[model samples]
Target: MSSTQEFIDEAAKIYKVLSNSTRLKILYYLRHQDSETDVKTMVNDLGLVQPIISKQLGILYRYQLVCRHKEGTRVYYVLDDPHVIEMIDDMLKHVKHEIKGEPHPRTLYDNKK
Candidate 1:
């Protein structure tokens, strides 16, 4: 594969991380939050157990899609690039349009007036 194909292949790996519902929910929450959070915090905020969160986080970290920082004994994570947030925001817009008032659905609205 050429360099461009290699880059696309790497991007596909990143997509694999985002492909999981739990992982995407985790990223969506963390990215929108104003402050960074540690694994324990992620477990609590996501209502997921420590081990599952850790495993998902490991995948995200491996792809360099997440930023990790240590303060004291706890490690906090943030988005490696702000563009990830932008991407999520763009997708959320489409989701909102697709699910608007639909039964048994997820809905999001932007107050960008």
Candidate 2:
């Protein structure tokens, strides 16, 4: 396969992982926060068990979609980059404001002239 094909295939794998709402929600929640939080927080907020979150995070880490840090016996996961957070945040903002309700105007006008 060509370089482009390889890239697309890799992207598809990440998308396949993200296609599940559980994983996507995990990513979304992790996207904003810089510091690593424990799985208990995920369970408390996302209602996912520690094992399940660990499994999904493993998949994300395998695909280079997330990074995990080991702190003694506990492992913490965070988005691989700030860009990932920015992209997800922008996407959520777009969907929430543009598609979920009446479409908000795309541009603002000034009457200073």
Candidate 3:
């Protein structure tokens, strides 16, 4: 088993990666995509600039949270991290609970033995 400090550090790292809304939206969009997409597609779909999308993608790629493929001069990205998907799902559930005035799963689970 890992130390508590190690777990804390890992959570902090994930939070850092997810702190940007652009990254979150990118991940959300990619989750439903059937094929790997390029920066231009993201820029067009998300209405964000190329540099912003590319920068967020770079961060995700650096953390190995996304898969990158190169075809000739173009690069494509796909959401590749199951843990990131779980985190996103959990966060969305928590937000839904908050909106519905219900207990969050995290809080309930944390209070359990």
Candidate 4:
């Protein structure tokens, strides 16, 4: 495949990963954390079952969107890229404006004032 197609494919994969609400919740939860978080903590805090959390975490790890480390018998996860967080934050702001029926401020894609 050409380099342009490869880049589009990778970008599509990332969007697919982010398309799930469960995964987005996981990312948002991790964003507020002060340190690496374990599965059990996520289960209790997010009100999700252990199996579901584990499954979603596996996908996040596979995408390299989150990093993990072993602590004793537990595995802890933290965000691997601040750029992903920024992208999510920007999208969220846009969403909020849409929901409020307010005009979104100029963004890179906007050429008109």
Total clashing pairs for each candidate = 0, 0, 0, 0
* Candidate No. with top lDDT: 4
lDDT at 93, model 4: 90
lDDT of 2 by residue, 4-96 (tens): 999999777766876777777888888766688777777787887889888888887887778888878878887775665576667678888
- Please report the TM-score between candidate 2 and the true structure: 0.71
Sort order, TM-score high to low: 4, 3, 1, 2
Give, for candidate 4, the lowest lDDT window spanning 10 residues. Answer: 104-113
**Poorest 10 consecutive residues of model 1 by lDDT?**
104-113
Model 4 global lDDT (CA atoms, 0 to 1): 0.94
User: Which is better, 3 or 4, measured by lDDT?
Assistant: 4
The C-alpha stretches of model 2 lying farther than 4 A from their native spots are: 85-113
lDDT of 3 at 52: 90
Candidate 2: clashing pairs of residues: none
Task: List candidate 4 stretches off by more than 4 Å.
Answer: 107-113
Residue by residue across 2-107, what tens digits does model 4's lDDT show? 9999999999999999999999999999999999999999999999999999999999999999999998999999998878989988899989998999997777
- What's the alpha carbon RMSD for model 3? 3.1
lDDT of 3 by residue, 37-98 (tens): 99888898999999999999999998888999998988899988867888789888888988
Give all candidates' CA lDDT scores.
0.80, 0.76, 0.88, 0.94
